[model samples]
Target: METSGAPQTRGARLHHPELSTLVHTSRFHAGRQPGATAVICEDRRLTYADLHHRSNRFAHALTAAGLAEGDRVAYLGKESEHYYEALFACAKTGTVLVPVNWRLTAPEVAHILQDSGTRLLLLEDAFTPTVEGMATEPPETVVRLGSLATWSSRYDDTEPEFEATPDTPVAQLYTSGTTGLPKGVVLAHRTFFAIRDRMAAAGVDWIDWRAGDIALIGIPGFHVGGLWWATQNFNAGTTVVAMRAFAARQAVDLIRDLGITTACVVPAMLRMMLTEPGVGAEDFTTLRKIVYGGSPISEALLEESLTVVDCDFAQIYGLTETGNTAVCLPPAAHVPGSPLMQAAGRPYPGVRVKTIDARGRELPPGEVGEVCLHTPARMVEYWGLPDRTAETLVDGWIHTGDAGHLDEDGYLFLRDRIKDAILVAGENVYPAEIENTLESHPQVAEAVVVGAPDERWGEYVHAFVVPVSGPPPTARDLHAFLVPRLASFKLPARYELVDAVPRNPSGKILRRELRDRFWSGAARNVN
Candidate 1:
């Protein structure tokens, strides 16, 4: 068996030419190293050969059911080997894979399916009722996760005849809708491999894959980070261990037992694993690197991680539109007490980043403005939304609604968010979504949502509500009302019943005024 390890030559392709697309990536590995481990999810272990054959069978099944190029297929379930098989099946058949977060409410799931024009839905058995309750227009075909193997078995394990281009849309990931409705972000096959190719050409090992290295997928497949990390490992012909869902104790056990070499996680996940009961340095002996992002790591937590983990720590910063990570704080700058610790590192090779003022003019270093990024890994567009796409992606640069300044040396320091999205344990929660739900309550006349700093979970949702003429509803009353409509992460941890919300002369609710109360003593408004 021949496995392509870490890239060794500068200005060379990361892998063979055949690995351009996800379908070709699977075929290349299966042909070169058939028996190599591809994915390990709980009790299930799938080899490269198995993955290739199973995905081929699923692809055949999809095509047999009339799904053709550019069709959308959604997967609503926990992370598992079947999910990867479905993903590769979509890649092979030239269909778009829409991964729905299982934690979402039924209405949320339905919105993604309807919004994406999903033709088929592959879901877990537990969510059967969830789909059945979608009285409105649902997916045309629904296949339970357990029956997929049996259903796909009727077809032969032959590769699909269709070939997807490098620019072909393969995945459509939904973002937490900043405007009360989530939008699907369409990503091409190139988004996964472009950064690796750039890194190989630049001879950089900031985030590298090596021979005999087993990687852990701490993030879920529903997020771009998890999918990108998994594909990066598969492209390198390395083994991957995926958890159905992230659990701190299971992560610690996997690191200790599976000889896991590298893992990608968020700061909150790292904190949980580090603080897991009976966890210590001895359990992380085989771990080599931890790539963390989604939220910045506090100095106290970073110091504790450095002392206990005894491994290299790297930070990644980007949005779903940037295909997970465009800026990486490499391990070389992980020195404790150094000023660089507070900065988000420079862009990867073949990537460009800059800050711009409200007038759309580029700003010089030391000037705070909206952060923008341009990379080969950028998403194609927000599905079915031309105006939204134009507003976000201007002149090939993604206008990340984040407020930050670039230092003289090019290290990016994040100050706050230009938009009103809350970061709850690395999950994006829009304020408008929560405010809309709160205002739906009969007793609530008006509502304002904001993000409040917290030691755990990074930030918690805080809501201010104005009641009707009669009696006002308590925080508990609103919490109970929202439980069925909103995801737990988006629910406000604290609520204040006010006679009137602070507003400007134009009747625009003053969110910053209410938000400033919680962040008065904090160094930066964003947690």
Candidate 2:
């Protein structure tokens, strides 16, 4: 009911007033159209006013629980209005928000909570087993996030004073790396606002928010893509349908049933949707556009999706460090079976993209090098890792470990990853993370994980293991061991028993040497 506000003047306010932090975006929308439907999840539909009030109450709840300004709060659950409530509440109170991956194992979850020094954890009931089993120090304070209605009612709707300034860190996103444990990337609220202002200034109406737009969010909000995409629609005062978890059929049905104008997802998601039963061409009739990224969509899949889905598709190219997307392959560039489709597109306004060599000097177009960018939304620093932060963030530029080149037409084309990371359905699975799990097995002498070409999921995990003396463990044994420790996506699709793992003279595992043969025939190293 009254979801659209009588077509407000386009590009009303790029950033929230005064502080220019994400803290007040919901309040601004609440002031614009309090009655408009803001979020739809399961049996609940929250209006803009509801979102503002609820988030404000949640903020009060945080303070009442003894949370101080800049204190860390972690959310370990699925996508729900409560997550948004906590997210916005953090912005208002200057508390740090950490959306933990619910899919991670107990130890994985504990590591993030401990690393961030999270004072409190807001968890759902389903994940009780995961948290209850954590080996590390459990959070000092815990709140049942899903059952917050009764608790929040005790607090007033008075908005928490906006405390975080433009340069203050708002969110901490943990990202896995090839060399060590997951690193937390600290992002400032101004970064999000700056990125939005840049995108709005570009004048790409197809990608920009407008009246009557209904957004279906399929990605998990824990990831940068999901949070940024959802916030983009929320700021636009559009009706947002946030999926609890991604299911291809659910997405296809929602696109038709909810008359969703646009959806943001990755290539692997599209592949799954196309294969789902009853997912016909007519099911996508209501969709005006589909924004896809993370990893490149296969040419065959892209052609099939274009034929079946009667809507323009756009591609976003960026990373967790870059806030979200800094560049985009617009709908106009979505020609079926074209070379341009292979490129990652040009940089957005306020973002400068270039290729740089080992010397850190900019390379000319067409020269392959590390694909780096200077975005207004760059992460403040890697939490606690000054050396790593220095290595990645140099002179206001993000050194994306991706090796790629720019074409004559300024299109950014990805070639390979300079880091040993496997892209499993848009989620990064570091070899070290998996290898660490594997080496822990008493029977396993060593293990190596690499991305192998996969038709459906873009690239699936493939592990090569060297066993200790006796007959090696079967795939079943390995699967059983991994099922409880790692996420399903990170589990190897297939395993190979090897005599010895490839290693350099210094005893470091030579992963590229092992991957060279499998990827040599492919067009690019990355799937």
Give all TM-scores, in the order shown.
0.80, 0.79
Which one wins on lDDT?
A: 1
Which ranges of candidate 1 are over 4 A from the true structure?
1-18, 420-527
| Per-model CA lDDT versus the true structure | 0.86, 0.81
Q: How many angstroms is residue 11 displaced in model 2 relative to the true structure, after the best TM-score fit?
A: 13
Predicted model with the maximum TM-score? 1
Q: Lowest summed-lDDT stretch of 10 residues in model 1?
A: 1-10
Q: Report clash pairs, candidate 1.
A: none
Q: C-alpha displacement of 289 in model 1, angstroms?
A: 0.8
